[model samples]
Target: MSRASRLLTLLQMLRGKSRPVTAATLASELEVSERTLYRDIAELTALGAPIYGEAGIGYVLRSGLFLPPLMLNADETEAVVLGLRYVDQRGDEELSKAAADAMAKIAAVLAPRPRTHCAIRPCCPARRATASPTTRCRSMCSARRSAFRPRC
Candidate 1:
């Protein structure tokens, strides 16, 4: 597997454990040399992955810390870009700015070639006569909130 895949797997292993796992154990499980494991760990930390540990003690990903190298498919990326563009066009000034900032953050993590896919473009449907921009924004926000709400 690729180094990036190995790093992601290592992160998953660290996240699964409640207590520190020794370097020997991790290296054994990952099928990599102790030195390679150490180097991988260092790279992950440098990327702000919230991994915490020392050489002998092993590592742990901090609870509730979400780091991104978010893997999104082309379709998913398009959907996100389109949604952000819609928000930028229809949301109020502050909300529009926030959406633009969010798009930038997402673009920063994407590969150079794929980053072009996120360029702002018109994606909003034709506006209704009665609903103002703010109204449209609120409607979109409410729809998203409801769609993502946890179901028991």
Candidate 2:
């Protein structure tokens, strides 16, 4: 299997476990060397996967905002496609590239037939904005901040 496929499989294995799994066990299951497994873990972490742990200790894949079990139906898959599509269109170069990578990861798990349900449109984005994503993300917190103000 390709490195990409192997990495996805590795991720699946990690997800199946609730506790940390040693490198030797993972390497044995993946049919790869311990050295290569370490590298793959690093690569996944770099790609924004919430993988944690060290060399001898083993690794664990923690659930984060965007990662569910990936047991998505066609409609759900379409929704993810639409949202990531928006990120691709309006985000800056780095953001756009990250979005592309994320899209690829989503695709890796979904079958081609289900993906056909999604509308892959190169749709236009609204006029470019000066604000960075970080700034825009902070702006989204304003509504909640007032609601959760300190109870002094």
Candidate 3:
């Protein structure tokens, strides 16, 4: 992965941990040497990430720190939009609302251009060609359907 992606992954991993994580474990998870992990952690610290720890001891992220999106490109954003849309279409009542809520969260974090693209009409990436017969919602709907939502 690119350094930016690696750094983002590191931040995510650290954020997910409730307790301090060892340098060895974090390095292994990142597929980088402990040296590299140290340097990256230093960089993150310089960048104002509230990571605290020593060499032998584990590192921990301070509670309630917020990190911005580093590398969600347009295509990836579109794919996320599509996946959420699919969930909205096929999921039950609670799940569908959850999907909507998740999309709102995504949009809130996204940059202006991609956020607009994901929130508007062009968000859904469903295609008729990729739809499978078994996913049909009802017999009366239609023979052909979009990859996600059932459509006539």
Candidate 4:
């Protein structure tokens, strides 16, 4: 991957994760050396990726008034694909179609770009789940709104 692409991936890694991520962990995830990961993170911060961290303390994305769309590294892309696949399998017809359409949209938006690109479909088997799509969607929407206005 190009330097810019790697930096974008690093941003995504920092964003997706709920906790701080060490350079070594990032390197292992991105399949790059620790030095390279540091360089990439430095460049990402320079590019306004909001990656925050220190030596020995891993990185964490700081919350703000605006939360940008989390960019996807290759692994994240695969994980999303896999998750969507599971959702599609377990969800109803309409929900499954929606999930597939969303994934397609994500690919279209990210493809033909210089960033981390992933096209292969994930093969992980999806186990059954009991949550209804409407319930899940409503809960997610509510959570998002609440997160943005937690003090209210």
* Model 3 agreement with the true structure over 46-86: per-residue lDDT tens digits: 99999999767799987435546435897677567767876
Give the Å shift of residue 53 in candidate 2.
0.7
lDDT per residue as tens, model 4, 1-152: 88768776666666456579888999998999998887887776676656779889898765441243446765566556656765676789999877776664465345343123323433334222777887766765554333233131
How far does residue 55 in candidate 4 sit from its true spot (Å)?
1.7
Q: Between 3 and 4, whose lDDT is larger? A: 3
Candidate 2: list runs displaced more than 4 Å: 66-152
Per-residue lDDT tens digits of candidate 2, residues 24-143?
Answer: 999999999989998999999899988999757779887443364356886577557756766788889999877776775665455546544333554333332887887765654442
RMSD of model 1, in Å? 13.7
C-alpha lDDT score of every prediction, in listed order: 0.74, 0.70, 0.70, 0.62
Q: What lDDT, from 0 to 1, does candidate 4 have?
A: 0.62
For model 2, state the Cα shift of residue 82 in Å: 31
Candidate 4 lDDT at 38 equals: 78
Candidate that beats the other on TM-score, 1 or 3, i.e. the better one: 3
Model 1 agreement with the true structure over 1-152: per-residue lDDT tens digits = 89999998887777656578888999999999989999998999898788888767768777545544557877677768778877888999999978877775676567555566665345565466799889888876665444333343
Model 3 spans > 4 angstroms off: 67-152
Judge candidate 1 against the unseen true structure and give its global Cα lDDT, from 0 to 1.
Answer: 0.74
Q: What's the C-alpha lDDT at position 143 in model 3?
A: 19
Q: What's every prediction's RMSD, in angstroms?
A: 13.7, 15.8, 11.4, 12.2
